[model samples]
Target chain A: MKMLRNLLCSAALASLTATGAMADGHGWSLKKAAAPYAGTTVDVVFLLRPGYEAIEAMLPAFEEETGININIIKHPYENALGEQVRDFVAGGDLDIALIDLVWIGNFAENDWILPLADVQAKYPDAVDPKLDMDDFFPLVLNAFGGWNDTVYGLPFDNYSGLMFYNRCMLEEAGFDGPPATWQELKDVYGPALTKNGKYAFALQSKRNETQSADSFARVLWPFGGSFLDANFKSNLNSAESQAGLKFRQDLMQYMPDGIVAFDHAETVNGFSQGDIAIITEWSAFYSSVVSPDTSKVADCVEIAPEPMGPAGRKPALGGFSLAVASQADEAEQAAAYLFIQWATSKANAREYLERGGVPARQSVYEGDDLEAFKFVPALVESWQDGVPEFRPRFAEWPEITEIVQEWGTKMMLGDVTTEEGATEIGTRMESVLEEAGYYSGEKPLAQ
Target chain B: MRGQVSRKTIFAFVGPAVIGLAAVGIAPLIYAVWTSLHFYNLTKLKKVKFIGFENYSTVLTDEVFWQAMGRTFFLLVTALPLQIILGMSIALVLHQPGLTLIKTLCRLSLVLPMATTYAVVGLLGQVMFNQKFGVMNQLLGGADINWIGDPENAFAMIVFWDVWQWTPFVALVLLAGLTMVPGEVEEAARLETKSKWTVLRYVQMPFLLPGLVAVLILRTADTLKLFDMVFTLTRGGPGSSTEFISLMIQRVGFRGFDQGLASAQAIILLIITIILAQIYIRVFYKEV
Candidate 1:
């Protein structure tokens, strides 16, 4: 398993193989890869988030440049997975598959998406010369697209959780900047910031992926905890995990009331409206909170890498990859690959970043030499040693996430003790992993 | 020859209906049962196989399933009576004579909530019941009550939404029933007893029975399968405090990708619903 992981890690640089060898039109051109498929249309699900909106803004240029009509199906984040699953299961007209980090296992294991090798083998001439995986951060590339030593997607909208704090609020509370660590946030800043019905922090603990990724897993890793152990057993009840959770419960009095029901929108809104001092959210939502039109305190908002813990800074990782759906016809698949490649290409990374997207390209971050984007430095810092398996990249994760949302909320609501919540979640997670042959010799510990 | 001719005519007449029923209804039920008997998960298609009764047993024993069932029953028991009582009272008030213009306007206003879409109602609930910026908190002098975040309060809000949205429809149904009472009989009852309660109990109550039965059956079934409103509102949140059986089935099927377990749960819910319907007919339903 270590050797396989090493191989996967090395494969992250496979795209760099073409760094020097390139034709005209910015090393690789859509004119070459997508010219033949001029009229071909590639349909994909574009979520209603800022990242997808940025991608959508470039579609017109893409159509004009390559003549490959990108047909986008708009869906809310909550509904995108279900739509993608339905499309994949039914072999629908969808040409591109958006694989969330956690869904890499389900999509790849089911062959719902075509691996990069398959795409290259089928369309060598159409494959870009500069489509280097090395350009992407290994963490983002591997988590979003890679599974079982194979690449199935290109990182489109990758994220690392960062602290979006109100500097004015912090200053008002006699602080110069955001807290450097979770301990400081609780012991020092929490008391100062939380006053007059306002809160020091807002976590999106809604009973959905928000609770699972943003609330549950976000706390676990920083405190030296994880969802599973070395043998894929439940590690949720570990002392580290319970400490993290207990810390959360202790900090509850400092948060706004009804925080257990807050989703991403609510949490972000609370921060933007200046009701909360801090919010730990994905980088993808930066544009919304920073924009003057959307945020009441846009000027006061500051970006920082997530607060540290005993285990160090393990920021929550979440994002999606754009891959060619296996169900599409050969020509459509090629066209789909062309569109995704053009969208995430190193050449377009700057433009993608400019349009409110958190691009995964290292070159893009490097090109911003002046450091205009506030979150870029923080992103680099977090992705340097972030947890790749922040949430288990397995088919059973959705089930396990649902379980977490349930018990995690109950724990927050004080209906269940932290031990009880952890035990319940651990037992359920073990049952799921066991059913998936993790206990038997059939499956390897993918970590 | 006559017997043969009659047999052919009967076959021609009834065959289309039977085929249509089988195609539209029975076939899907059978297919669902077949699916329930297997270890079918869309993600693990390769592992699909017949695992008869295993899914059923799992669902039957699952704590989430039981909790969802209990919450759903709680909503039904609580929401139905409130809707019925409020509905009947409003119907009775409107049944009185005079104030024609006022009565007509009030009746029109009652249909407003029912007219709005179910999903929208859920969205409205989310916005209105929000902790910080919600109108509900703002109305109470900007109180910081944790409305939907608390389990019991969240459940109560869901029930309140159901009653608020559906009581009008029930009132409309009962109003139609009240209008059917004979004018002469009501006048005679009024003349015999100067008590309006007596006239309502004896003269109009009989006419309301059929409408009452219809409301009970429809509401019961609707409550059992209510998805859109609650899904939009809380999504069975704050630790499954507001999770209904439909939401539970959805979680099993859609989120877990375990069609077999979802199907088994559906089947169990179906049996429960049918039994409840029977009980409603036996108790509240009358020949009148």
Candidate 2:
């Protein structure tokens, strides 16, 4: 038995040698002698979004076609991108990666991603021609994937902040429809809707990326404020912006106090359980909110545009992007690009949307299948009007989020004055920018 | 003595395990230390340049780091005493007679929170404390109170969560100590006509000293590193009131993308933990 096993191993080794030689001879370059990697299984790190199972299930067909085995490693959205960045810097072996839109600037700045231009040039036909860069809603893709005029990543799943409310609750509160403006939301609907055991709103106030994206950023643009001036100095502390922050804090008085502890799930649960009247949440959560099994308020929930601030209505854009690893081998890189192309193709996006995924493309929003889905029209309109704050995209976003969460939550709790919070955020943000070389000691970015 | 084994045999037994230890432990420790000394810029594409004590100084001086530290300590203060008191009360209850079924049920109930995943626990806590239909508010007729939105309520919820999950762990330790008390000693105290309070103060507590030490040591370390409960609960919210050290480290390391600074902050936390452990050990082992 030992002799037979040895003989089989020798035969397998011979085949492996032959394949390695063949790979080197057939245009494969490597620092060491090349192996074809045809049968070698590699893990493709995927962030497990709502509709990702179908994309993962489709991978077997690609594996069969390519003659290479694929393994899927799923991670939460934030951790996956954070791990990808660490892996790239440490030269760790990661074949494929999923990243968020706001992470593009930092990824691009550090050259952590492989530029797809080379892959596109090589596989024009393999790449989806229908991607039609022009077809994507300008703000969605522009905020996430575009950096220094280069398209760094492909949009995977994209969504904008939209106001989701209990239509029944609104009607019960003596309103026939959702509030149209910030004043109406605060003065009229918020007070009227707030009653014995229910809150008027369930907006996220807990400091994190979600708070920055869905709540704070969405309110800022509507109030005619931006994170930075044209020169990239911190501009979130303006009086108009403070008004927006204060308005959100005041609104919390009528909402659930546990909002300080609430992230996306708590807020969604609050609304879906018919505990709160309204929630300004991501479009991606639409299907779940309206699904009967998951939500008691499903039929009662209706989508509406984000409320207008003093200046105008501006909704925050939230989305994901696909970027290939710089360190992935030739075959892996080719596989990644192919996977991205297929995963984000027009057909795939439509399929994803039909399965309740939010698509980045404008055309997908108009699809008959999507229109049939509940709240699709409102979601589409919100995407069209999305005011993408772009997360400031500095490497310091995590720290920036901390600053925002600390002060934002404090303001909501009435622990800090808006001016105090805003001034502190602006000061800290300036120092971060200065350290990042966006500003000099002699003159701050704004100065 | 059989201690003098063959040198070759000794090496044969220890070599692979030592190599494994170094591979898993020493390598990362060294790497973390090395990384902690450098700028470790993520956006700049530049190799990590050694910045000596710069990152450490920055972390020490950074206002946010101090704020997170304060918040972390605040959570500890809110959680620790409540956890100890509740745990002792439960432990005392479990010591009663003819309560076997009740004791078993109580044990099972107390263990449930620890058994639950933090995300679920956090979400459940939020739901219970929800200003509207939350069971906690509804039970208290606090239908209008927002338990997580306001700073005070947010802090209260975090404390409630910390106590809920951990009080049982403390109770279990104290209960174990309660069971170790000698029947004869208790009987002697009873025969001496000792007051209930005196018996508890002198006999019961002194015997539970080791157990109390064990609970305090574990709780202190656990409370110091409290992350998921807060992260899942308040996410260090209605601003920085709920922010703690672990979340702060994550914010700095992953979001800020400044490994050196994060590492520096982490080292400070490590030092604090070590100092606290030392203090605990000294007090525990002190000759009274």
Q: Could you estimate the TM-score for every candidate? A: 0.96, 0.81
| Deviation from native of the Cα of residue B28 in model 1, angstroms | 2.4
Docking class of 2: medium
How many clashes in each structure? Answer: 2, 14
Per-residue lDDT over A148-256 for candidate 2, one digit per residue giving the tens place of the 0 to 100 score? 5456576777777788989998887678988888878889988888887788987775567766776677667888787777777667778778778777777776777
| TM-score top scorer | 1
> Looking at model 2 chain A, which ten-residue stretch has the lowest summed lDDT?
A28-37
In every candidate, what fraction of the native interface contacts is reproduced? 0.76, 0.85
Candidate 1 lDDT tens digits, B1-288: 666678778889999999999999999899889999999988888899999899999988988789889889899999999999999999989988999999999999999999989899999999899876789999989987778888888898899899999999999999999999989988889899999889888888889988998898899999999999989998988778888999999988998788899999999998998998898889978765
Chain A only: list TM-scores of all candidates.
0.96, 0.85
For model 2, residues B1-288, the per-residue Cα lDDT tens digits are 567798889889999999999999889777777878998856445757998998889989988789888887888877888888889999988987787898899888988988988778887876787665689978886567777766677778888888888899989988888887788887798788758777777677877778887777788778777888777776666566667888888777776677787888888888898888788777864321
